[model samples]
Target: MTLFVDMDEVIADTYGAHIKRVNERYNMNLTKEACRGGEVWQQLPDHREAIWRHYFEPGFFRELDPIAGSQEVLRELSEKYEVYIASAAMQFPDSLKEKHEWLDEYFPFIHWSKRILCGDKHILRGDVLIDDRSHNLEHFVGRSLIFTSPHNVNTTAFERVNSWEEVCSKLL
Candidate 1:
């Protein structure tokens, strides 16, 4: 089975970092607690790219933290499937590289042959696609693990889960 994984909010808390950076750089009173379900960008309309640039411009993915239990879950999943890092992060190439490097650092157990990077994850054609974006799920062709996003509630799905731990259970 080919398991397509998304970077950002699914494995790492990129959205959280974005929020913190926005508050720090723009002196906004926004909190990471408020940027949920598509509200992340809404909270910082003035300094959007500034926050993104802070993390992905020079490539900050190398220092990012995987979501709690993310490494363990991916490690286990890798044992049973072909794990592919298929992300739609082309809008930020440097950030994408950083994310891939972080995954390689944390989940080295996965073979290089199993890793697949792409801009549109729907093209990967995996048995399962795990992503936080609702539109991505609509584009995918198989079973999907729709990770919860504070900013995407307007989009709906039948298989949405609130956390990676819950996804681990459902997938296993």
Candidate 2:
């Protein structure tokens, strides 16, 4: 099967990184639970632009930690299926290079040829798409697996998996 996986939130800990950076920069103690059911910027309405600025900052994508168990599960899945990292990277100019470096450090098994750094997901053709955003999966003509994020906990539009372990149980 051709499995196209999203980078942010799904495999990369972008939510956690944003929270951590925002807390340190703004001197606010915001937990993941506090930002549940919405984006981090939504939680910090006053610092919305500041929070969004974090993504555009240098090394933002490079410094993100991997979602727990994602590496192992993805490596296993790569052995069984044709895996690809499909990320909306064009929005951020630095993300293209930083994401590539991040993947090399964490998921080196996923080669450059398999990485789909595109602006829109509608152009992708795959058997399955695993992403955190419902919009990305909206036009996807495949099995949509919604990888859980703090912001998307309340979403019920598609099949949801809270952890990489749950993903393994379903896909592997």
lDDT for 105 in candidate 1 is: 87
The residue-by-residue lDDT of candidate 1 on 13-108, one tens digit each, is 776677666667667777655655565666666756655456555756666667778888888888888888776767766766676677678877
As a whole number from 0 to 100, the lDDT of residue 106 in candidate 1 is: 80
Q: After superposition, which runs of candidate 1 have C-alpha atoms over 4 Å from their true positions?
A: none
RMSD of each: 2.1, 0.8
Tell me the lDDT of model 2 at 20. 95
TM-score of model number 2: 0.98
- Show the colliding residue pairs in model 1: 36-150, 36-151, 37-149, 37-150, 37-151, 37-152, 38-150, 38-151, 38-152
lDDT of each: 0.73, 0.93
